[model samples]
Target: MADELTTRSALQLRDLVAHGEVSAEEVARAHLERVAATDDQLKAFVTVTDDAALAHARDIDRRRAAEEPVGALAGVPLALKDVLCTKGVRTTCGSRILQTYRPPYDAGVVERLRDADVVVLGKANCDEFAMGSSCENSAFFPTRNPWDLDRVPGGSSGGSVAAVAGFQAPLGVGTDTGGSIRQPAALCGLVGVKPTYGAVSRYGLIAFASSLDQAGPIARSVTDAAHLLAAIAGPDPRDSTSIPKPLPDVLAGLDDGVSGLRIGVVAEFMAEGMSDGVRAMVEASVERLAGLGAEIVEVSLPHAGYGLAAYYLIAPSEASSNLSRYDGVRYGLRVDGATTEAMMAATREAGFGSEVKRRIMIGTYALSAGYYDAYYAQAQRVRTLIARDFAAAFETCDVLVGPTSPTVAFPLGELTADPLAMYANDVYAVPASLAGLPAMSLPVGLGEAGMPVGFQIMAPLLRDDLMLRAARALEAEVGFDAMPRGPNALAGAAI
Candidate 1:
């Protein structure tokens, strides 16, 4: 029963809890035990709030007993990416500088989760300040992929997706700036959603790239991802960037078949450079979608090749500005120096990791006086072109399809020395983010190294429901089995 509960989808667990078939406490404890048993090997969690999770579970049980109205995800266990502030809980963003820091208020998503009665297992690990493509950049420790213990789980939401994929949690909340959520979800063989930018509130979320960063859901199935997304997505007064309109009903049309829907396959994404296995798997998935009655059309994003270069400049520039608040004089780490300037320098030098520092330097240089127009401004112009590309492509199709990542999860330390290789992992994913459109990664099949290959579905801004509908249709055709077979294979077997 415990194992069954651990492996169940969030919606399934919620239904079971709602029907009184299982108490919320029992469900929470089952997942807690799974985390305790598997997280040591997976290293997905930065903190495990077992006591708090149980306490929340007990409250949910009381509510159910009293016949009080419970939210859609009443008893679901969730893993929150460490980047979202969780009130009294430590929100590290996987950086040592804020290791001991705890926010006085919960992020908008956290508040929504609490309101929905979802029990947070703990804060999941991520890249330092949400900055890297691999979990190796985490200041605490790298989160290993559950499919192969020696390979990396993608980042900066590595721990969030890892937790769900490893059966430690039924669902997770992760932020996506440059495919942080989708890339990791792809590598982990889970469903990851990046809602249209500003559709989900960013208030209380530790800023990475303020304009680009948006929080969304990670789950084992499309239905589960839709349920979680509904709970946390909506307008928030605290976030100026948040859209004031009501969120579309993501689940209402989720099961709607994609009979006449046109799916645009980006011509450039299929050109070359990825492993043959990955390309073949993605093509097979596309064929499957076509087989399911959806029309497949070839669409070209002429400037797609420039997405990586533009994203690096825009995201890092925003990150550079947003991270400026962490000076020694403020709340995070402080190192003594002869003067204030030296102290701030020492603090940042000691607090940031190599990847974070690299981005900061590049961003600082891009935004510097003489180079601003040459770099930052030009990058912004390129961003506009990318968005325009998506706009033009959407006119010919209901949604776009592509491989989530060019390659599957690589072995640990494989790309550590090559930053460009790491950045290339987000090549296909960055274009949607740059356009502020809704996109999701659904596990379609296994590729090279027997790791998961993700099929990306993207919809125009505010049309998340359309994207999810297409994903659900494709998901049924793909029939992906997300069971991993590494150190936690026994745990999964028990499930």
Candidate 2:
């Protein structure tokens, strides 16, 4: 019965708790036990807050018993990516520097989650400072894809998505800066959302690429993703970039099928480089959408090819600026030296990992005198062009469709030796981030090695509801079997 509870969707669990069929404590314990059982193999979490979770669950049960008002996601268990600040709980962005650093206050989204009565199971792992495409860059440990133990769970939200996919959590919150959330959600066979920039507050989220980082939901189903998005989507005065308006009704028209919706297929995305199996699966997904009455059209984003190069420059430059606050004098790890400059250098050298160092170097170089205009400034220009492409394309289509990644989950260390190869994993997902548009990845089917392939749906800026509606429509048609298979399936079953 506990394992059965673990397999249920977030909404299903919520319903059970609401109807008195089961206590929230039972649901929380079920997932916590699953995490304990599998995290050694999955490495999906940096910390597990069993006590806090049970306390929150019991509180929710008390509120229900008293007939008091409860938030939308009351008692749902969730995994939070370590990038979000959690008061008194260590939030390590998968780096040694801030491994012991606990925020004095919660991030805006975290506060909202608490208000919604969501029980955070723990802090999920990620690439050090959310800089890498694969979780292997973690200063602590790499997260393995649940579909195949030897493969990487896509990152920097690898652990967050893995928790959901591996049945350790029903929902997860992860920040997407250049595909961190969606890519991992793809590899893990989950519904991952990258809401439009400012759709969710970025106030307490540790900076990556400020312009690109947006926190969103990773869930087992599209409907669950929408519910999670609703809980955290409103404006926050703490975040200057937050959209100063009420969030749209995402669940209002979620069930309205995409009968007459126009879904544009990016001609460039279909050209080459992706594995044949992934391409076939994505193409089949598009066909399935068409069969469900979506109007299919081929659209061109001539500047789309440059998105990768532009992102590498722009994201790194921003990272360099944001990370400079981590000098020896501040809150996180500090290495002492004879002089201030020496201490700063020593602290950074000791604190940051190899990938973080590589990006800081690239970013500093790009932002250096005489090179800013040629690199960082030009990347910003390319960003504008990419946004223009999305705007122009959206004029003819309601949303764009493509493969979330070039291939499914790859073995650990496969691309670790080649940074360029690792960066290419975001080729399909980055354009939406660069454009600050809303995008999502949902499993269409399995591809090579029996790993999941995601079909991405993107909408114009501030149109997250539209994007999710299309995803839900297709999700209903595809009926993706999100259950884990093989040995991993047995793990969940035995939990």
Candidate 3:
């Protein structure tokens, strides 16, 4: 029974805990054990809070026993990406610089999770300061894909996806600056949502491209993702960017199928450079959705081709500004020197990873005196064009669909030496981010090596429900199994 608990979905576990059929502590233990059993190989978590989780579970159990009202996700364990600040818990944004810094207050999303009675098992790993397409850039360690240990689990949100896919947790929260959440979900065979910007509050999230970063859910099923999203989606005074508009229940019309909905297939997303295996898988999913009564049409996003170049400039520029606070004087790793300036320089040189420094340099240059108009301003203009492209496409389509990642999970270290190759992974996933639209990656089928392929679904601004409805519809038809088969690291995890 304990081993079987790990296979259950978040909703299933929620029901079991809420009904008192199983104590919350028991469920927490089952997942903690799974993490202990597999984390050494997968490197999914930077810190495992077994003691904290068990205590949280006991509190939930006590509430249930006392017949007190509980939140929507009572006693469910979740893997929170380390980028979000958690009160008293070390919030290492997968970097050594802030490795020891613990926020005095919980992030807005963390507050929501606690209110929802979610148990956070640990701090999931990520690319340092959420800056890479692959998890290999983490200062602590790289997260290995559960599908094949030799391969990479897609970037910054890889740890969150790894936990759910490896059965270490049934739910997780990850941020998408570019495709951090959806890209990782694609490689790991899970459902990942990048909610429309402002749909979820960004307060207390360690800044990383503040304009683009959004916290969303990673789960094995569409409904599970909706439940998680609802718990954290709403206006918060703490986050000025949070939507002031009242949020509708995210799960209200979730299961309603996509019949009569027009799903636009982005032509730019299907262009050359997509692997044959991935192309075939996405093409087949479009056919299946058509059979399910969704109107399929090919739409062109001509400006989308420039999304990559613009994102690189905008994200890094914001990062350069946000990261300037880490200059030795503030809490975190500090290296002393004779002068304050020397100390700050030495500290940053020692604390930050190579990728972070690279981005900082790029961003600093783009924002420099002479280059501002030519680079950053131009990039912002390009961003506007990309948003216009999406707006034009949405006029005739209910939701846009395409391959999330150009290819299935690539082997670890294959593209590490060539950074440009890595940047290309987000080609299909970036335009939606640039447009501030609600987007998701749903497991469609296996591609090369029997690994998972994710079908991307995007909806108009503030119409997250529409995208989810389309995803649920196609998900019902494709029915991809998400169990990992990567050697003995987490083999038979679902069992």
Estimated TM-score for each candidate: 0.98, 0.99, 0.98
Give the best candidate by lDDT.
2
Evaluated against the true structure, the overall lDDT of model 2 is: 0.93
- Give all candidates' CA lDDT scores: 0.91, 0.93, 0.91
The lDDT of model 1 is 0.91
Residue 292 of model 2 has an lDDT of 91
How many steric overlaps are in each model, in order? Answer: 0, 0, 0
Q: Please write out the lDDT profile of model 3 over residues 258-370, one tens digit for every residue.
A: 78988899998888878888999999999999999889999999999999999999999999999999998858989999999999999999999988999999999999999
Which residue ranges in model 2 land beyond 4 Å of their true spot?
487-490
Clashing pairs in 2: none
Q: In candidate 2, where is summed lDDT lowest over 10 consecutive residues?
A: 485-494
| Model 1: pairs clashing at backbone N, Cα or C within 3 Å | none
The pairs that clash in candidate 3 are: none
- Tens-place lDDT per residue, model 1, 199-288, is 999999999998899999999999999989999999999999999997799989999889999999999989987788889989998999
